[model samples]
Structures are given as C-alpha cells and as structure tokens.
Target: MKNQEIAKILYEIADLLEIEGVEFKPRAYRKAAQNIESLSVDIEELYKKGQLEKIPGVGKSIAEKIKEYLETGKVRKLEELREKIPVDIESLSAVEGLGPKMIKVLYEKLGVKNLDDLERVAKQRRIRRLKGFGEKLEKKILEGIEIARQRQHRFLLGFVLPEANAIMEELKPYVEKISLAGSIRRRKETIGDVDILAVSSQPEKVMDIFTSMKRVEKVLAKGITKSSVRLHGGIQVDLRIVGKESFGSALQYFTGSKEHNIEVRKIAIKLGYKLNEYGLFKGFERIAGRDEKEVYKALGMQWIPPELRENRGEVEAALNKSLPKIVEYDEVKGDLQMHTKWSDGANTIEEMVIEAKKLGHKFIAITDHVGSLKIAGGMDEEKVMEQAKEIEKLRERFDDIYIFHGIEANIMKDGSLDVSNSLLKQVDVVLASVHSAFRMEEKDDSPRNKSDRK
Candidate 1:
C-alpha cells in the first residue's frame, strides 16, 4: 500500500521540478507516478522482487529512487528539490487555470508562494499590473482561489477508491455482507469522505479491525455499532455494523443524496408506511428490509441504481417502472482509447494488445499521441506512417480481437488538427483534443464550434 505514499512524493517532485523550470523530466515523473498509483499490486512487494523497472513509464533512475525510498523511507533528490523550492506548490497549482509557468511567474514577481499569498496580491490589485495578467484574469484568479479553498479537503473519487476497496477486502472475513455507501457509492466526481455499511453479528470485532486498519493514520472514534478513521491520505472513513435483516435498509439510508432521501421519505409517508435504516414498517409491523428490491417493492416502485439516486427524476422513473439499465463492465466489448511505447505510453503495442485480449475485449484502438505535444514525444507524419506499418505486422499475430490504428491528434490554436487531413483519414480512429489555451474564456465561432452547436 506504499503505492499512494510513493506517488505523492513523486508528484511533489514533479511540482518542484516544474517550479525550477526544468523541462521534460517533470512529465516523465508525473507519468510514472500516475502508473504507480493505478497499479493493483503492492509496491512494496514489487520492490522486494526487484521488478520496479518492469512498471510502465518507470526507468532505471526512477526505479532506483523508488527502491531508495522503500529501503530508507526517504528520497534524497526529492528532499533537495523541496529545499530549493520551499513552498506548498501543489496546493497553489491546484487553483483553476493556474499552471506551473504562471506559478513561476507569480512566485518570482509577487512572492506568491501559496494560496494566501496569491489571494492577498489579487485583492490588492497588484496581479493585474503583471506582464500578461489583466483585471479580468485577476478577478478569475480570485474566484478560483475561493473555490480551491472551499474544496481543499475533498479528494478525487479515482484517487480514494483503491484505498477504500483495500480496507473493505480486509474487513470482509468479519462481516456477513459489506458495501460502500455515501458519495463513493453514488459515484461522485469528488468525495468528501468514505462511508461503509456491513451486516455483522459481531459488531465489536468489526469495529476494532476497522479502527486499526493499516492505512489508518488516526482513529477518530470507535463505538459498538460504528467506527471512524482517517486514512494516510486524509480521507475520513466511517464503518457501520447493522443486523443482516436491516442491511439493505441501512444501505439505502446511507447511500444517499439529501434531496433523493427527502423525496423517498415523502413517498413512504404517502404509502402509509414508515421507512428508516432499520426497515420499512406498516402499522408498526416490519414489512421489508432484507433486500433493497423488497424495500422498493414496499414503496410501490422499482429498485433504483445508486448512481441515479440524485433526485433528478429518478423517483418518477421508478414509479413508472421505466428506469434505464446501467451498463456493467461485462457489457463492454472493447477499448477505444489506449497508448503504446510509440508515444508516451508505458507498454509496447504488442504488450497492450495481449493484455486487451486477456481482458476479453473483442476490439481495441491504439490511439497514440501525434504532433507537437513535445512532452508526450508525439509522432510526426513520417513516424506515424512507420507506426502504421508496425501495427499492420502485429495484426497478423492476433486473431481474437480487431486492432485499430489510431491517433489522438492535438487541436491547434487556429482550430486545425496537428496532423494533416490526408493522414488522419487513413487512420481507423481519430481523437482530437485541446492541450493548451486553458485560460481562454471566449468560445470559437469556427466551423468546428458551429457543427458542435448545431
């Protein structure tokens, strides 16, 4: 579980390097950090096997650094970089529209080393007098700073899910049934904290194990029915143990949007029944609770998926028995976007194809980066043509899946693609995306915009 701990240090190193105006190395560090963070295997185990270099985007030097940290619990280079920069760059850089280059400029010009410093300078109207900043940009920076301050404690769903799943897996043996609830279950883009509910006859044992998890940095509370702990990454998690008969009702009550719960409660009242975490009751008799479907059946509605319980007409849909079917992972046939060593990806084309086939995919597209995105080592027309030939040869070896040659073309400032139209037309798939001009507020009236508008 040192994966996240190592990733955090790598990200901090990337920020320090960016602040120092070092080019290329920051992107490499960040890519390695991302791959490591997403790894399913324990990093400590990988280090033990001396296989850290086998990780995609990780090279000899980076692997050595990982080993150094694993062995000694410190990284010399990162500490030196931290001493040189000497600021909380990650927090400052998190503000919307604030990139490393702009951060460097602010730091050198106005001594803006953190959010507070930046906010103070913006309020004083000193930022507008800088070379490229204006009154409008200054106003936007202040707004972004305020938003960042408000959301500072929240973590991305993608970042926190792995830790949550790990904790649940460890607790599985002690509970009859367990499920994640709260924002994590609702699939929110950002989560304030984690909530877990379990059906267990042994609440005391479960609570003890929950509060003493390996990742727990602090045990906030430990009680008979519920326990709360803060993880190493500052994510607070609460675990509740309930009777098996009431598990479904408890899950529905906890996995909620406030608005959705209010609407459901109104429905319960209308039906002459009372509903709570314990169970659904009709005339003081417990009617349903063992399953979520039963609870919904008692309310004269279809069971709703957790993702759709946001008070966005889901209640009405359930009443009409017309809730949409949510797509499951098994329903996916292929992946449209992927990369290989031809661009910035960690694996080779053949390696990626083999893995895709193992995943039961019927098809895959290798959409590597192309043209002028120097940090990604984007391919030019000649290199892309070379890659196409290589992919053609590799196609001869695979019979189970259809492999498409693709490119993620960079959209230039003038609304033209980085790759020529002739080359683009030859590919099976093309992905056009914006990588710069993040601060531009005005919408383009170009043909691309017109088509999208229509």
Candidate 2:
C-alpha cells in the first residue's frame, strides 16, 4: 500500500468518527490524513519500519492503523467507518471543490449522497437554497459541470494520426500540397486533435469532398479558410485551404504552439512585417509575393524550423540570425534500434532489411536479443555465431544492400555488456538495453552499486 492509500483510509476513518460524535481524536486523525496526503515519502514503508510516528499528529494509534492496512489489507477503524456510513464516500467527495464536511451536510439533510443526486439537485437550483450555498456557489457549481463536459472534447494523438493521414491522402488529388499541421506536426505524444492545411485552386471541389467524406461523423463548422468536422472516432479534424502561393505561411500559422506563434509575431514586428495564418503582411502591402521564403527573408534569417519554435530562445536566435541545422528523419542513415523474430519481433531480419531498403536507408541492422532474456528466446554464444554466419551469407546474396550484423545485447550485473568483446566485433552496431533491474535503480538519481557481487 502507498502513503496516499493509507492517507485515504485515515481520511474516511476521520469522516466516520465525525459522524459518530467522537471529539478531538477524529480531528487528530483528520490532521494526520491531511499531512500524509501531502507527504512525498511512502507512509506504508515508514509504518513497516516503525517510523510513522515521525509525522506530526500521527500517534501510536494512527501508526498501528497504517501498519494494519499494509499487512492485512484492511484497517479495522476504516472498515467500521464504512459499515456505519453505508455511503459512496469517494463518489460524493469528487464534486468540484467540495470536501468532507460539506459532503456530510448534503448527505444528512437533503439525501444527496452521490454525484448523480448532487448534479440533479444543482440542475434544479435546489442546492443554492441550502445553507452555505448561495447564488454564487450555484453558478460556480454549474460552471464546474460545464468544464467536466468540455474535458471530453479532446482526443488522443495515437487515435487521431491514422485518421488524419487518411483524410490527407483522400484530398491529395485535388490539392497542390497537403500538410499535417497542429500538435501532430510538432510531434506531441498526446494531441487534442489534428489540423491539416491544403493548397488547392479548386476550393469548392475540395470543400465538397470534405463535407461528403464517410468518416466525418458531423461537420462542426465550415468557412472559406477553415472547416472542422467531428470524426467517427470522436476526434475533431480542422482543415484549412489556402492558395498555393500562401500555403507555406498558412502551414506555419496552423502548425503552432499558440504561445510560440505569439513570439513569432513579436519577432515579425521587430523586423518590418506582421505574421498571420494567411501570409506575411508588410504595413498595408503584401511582401514575399506568396511564399514563406519571403517571410524568413523579411525577418533577415534562415527558415525557422518548426520543432525549435517553442519560444524558449528561438525568437532571440532568429533575431540574431543564428540557428543550428536540425536533423530530419530522412537524414538518419540507418535505424540502430529495432527487433526481429530471432528474438521477439513479428518480422524476420530479411523482411526488416527489405523495408529499410524501400525507405532508401544506407544500411540495415538485424540486432536481435542475446541470452540474458530467456523469455525472448535469447541466443547463447553458439547461437550468436550461427546468426552472424547467416547474416554474412545474406550480405553476399543482397549485393545492393549493406546488411549490418548486429545484436541488441542485454546489460549484465556488475556493469558489463552481455556479449563477449570478440563476438561484439562481428556486428556493425551494438544496442544495449535493460530487460531487468528496472524498478530498483532506473530513476534519474537512483544509486547504482559498482562493486561486482560475482
């Protein structure tokens, strides 16, 4: 059990004590609960080692309760409390900004013991009629309810990527260029949704196609420059169509961390222009004609890379006209880390090599697991040499491709590589990873013992 879990048990115990008319003891438990909730240290571990009394207000009684929860999976006082109340305590407590005392009053007087009942009473305006709840409190509650609904408005990026790609592919014929913009373009691990910018002379045809798309559950809004749709998977897709000349500028605007764009605007002001999603404007006149090249040129700098546009120091760097050349995915000559079926991957080494060749990669590595990962069918030294010989044979057959023989070796204890160095020289690359000892010492500042036990 974690400290938070122990704290929660104590909080409920305090609530039950309050109802039972127990005096300062309940207050003491409540104080201990509050302290434990904020504690960074694990209370259950402390309790095991007889250190729980160190926390202020946590006496012998509370320390015993915490220890009971850790060993027996139940605290006696908490169980008794739950039995007496017979209420959905956690559910009632989840109401925005409402704590235990308020929950007790609501449950005792109005019979509003759960979220659904509370929501119903609030919607009916009866909650404001209760003591300690006035017109202002009711308005805040309704606003909180509205916020809860809005929280569901966004979608996960993993869920949205494929749909966005499908839509972009569908529009490719009509548009001169199509770019996936927004958070997806910026490579956010989780995204609210997707934004796509397209350049098309045939705007009406593009709009018609977009509106008639089968995957779009409903068209939220449609305008000249922009159109938004709620997809079948419950993600919103926003599309903007601009002229071919204005496409780059439009892309820069839509592919924004809004804060980053604000800084971009400030930089544009420092130069002699204004930046917008449409294009760069120069004081009641258009400059750069229609290209984003003109936008960077007007700012007296090389093209600002999108990934660096987080406003940290990119703005200052652009003003000074000094930015490092960022590496692109295409620039990576080979993929060093990957899996194959010789260990645990679904594909064979040859299939992975073929795929790499299709990507026009310079080299491909077939680095499967070695014997510390028995579950992955990790090979021993004999199997390692056999795989190496097989790779050499494949290299001769595939003359056009440079197939690098490699192994993703596991790290053994005593801080050493799994495979012998003589065997290591046969491969072009070595990828080291840990399949064990992860939980004990993988933290940013976790201690590692260097002395060999063996």
Q: Estimate each model's TM-score.
A: 0.88, 0.57
Q: Which pairs clash in model 2?
A: none
lDDT of 1 by residue, 39-141 (tens): 8789989988989998888999999999998788799999898777667777887788888888888988998888999999999999999998899889989
Model 2 CA deviation exceeding 4 Å by range? 1-165, 187-191, 199-204, 232-235, 242-247, 328-330, 412-428, 441-454
Q: What is the C-alpha lDDT of each candidate?
A: 0.88, 0.74
For every model shown, the clashing-pair count is 0, 0
Pick out the ten consecutive residues of candidate 2 with the lowest summed lDDT: 444-453
Q: On residues 1-454, what C-alpha lDDT tens digit does candidate 2 reach at each position?
A: 2555566688778767766677887788877887776565667567667888998778888888877877777888777777767666655554466666666776777777656677787888887888987877776666665554444455556556766887888999998889898888877766787888888888888877887797777999887778998775457888888877678787778788788889878878877788886678788676653666567667676677777767788767876878877888788787767677677665667777777877777788887888688778787878878888878887887777788777888876555787888778867788888786653544432225553233
lDDT of 2 at 94: 48
Candidate 2 C-alpha error for residue 37, in Å: 41
Stretches of candidate 1 above 4 Å error?
A: 20-28, 38-40, 53-65, 71-86, 99-113, 129-136, 438-444, 447-454
User: Clashing residue pairs in candidate 1, if any?
Assistant: none
In the order shown, the candidates' Cα RMSDs to the true structure are 3.7, 18.5
